[model samples]
Target: AVTRELALFKVACTVEQRAEILQIAEVFRSKTIDITEETITVEATGTSEKMDALEKMLANFDLREMVRTGKVVMARGTQIT
Candidate 1:
């Protein structure tokens, strides 16, 4: 089951900047159902280098108050169904 379409990334930003954060969705979305909190989520794609970059950026922006889940990748076009 290659869940490509189901791929996603769920990033939870600080409460004060949640709305302002989601607007920049493409910046951190990994295209997988990020089973994190109920706050925010993004849809994006990239490699390990990219993920590291994203993490660093998130840290620099002071947005990672808490991380709910580790990174998970889905196969192309694969879905839970």
Candidate 2:
């Protein structure tokens, strides 16, 4: 079965470096979850493969921390059992 997971990235880069990291999230179609003077947290939802790619792309940064969730399965329509 196909599955998708959620990934949350907490990056500890300087204010100067924040813009570049935000661009990374934009590139991966992710969203900014939170922001602080010293860090930026982003949330992304996609297949495991895509999440892996995002991780690799951000590996060169400060990357203070990261959290990934297990696959979530949901019904797309209103059809009930």
lDDT digits (tens) for residues 1-81 of candidate 1 = 322222234455566666555545555554333434444554444554565565555554444333323445555554443
Model 1: weakest 10-residue lDDT segment is 1-10
lDDT (10s digit) by residue, model 2, range 8-62: 9888888788889999999999999899899889999999888999988788788
**TM-score for candidate 1:** 0.37
Worst 10 residues of 2 by lDDT: 72-81
Off by over 4 Å in 1: 1-14, 29-44, 61-81
**Each model's TM-score, in the order given?**
0.37, 0.82
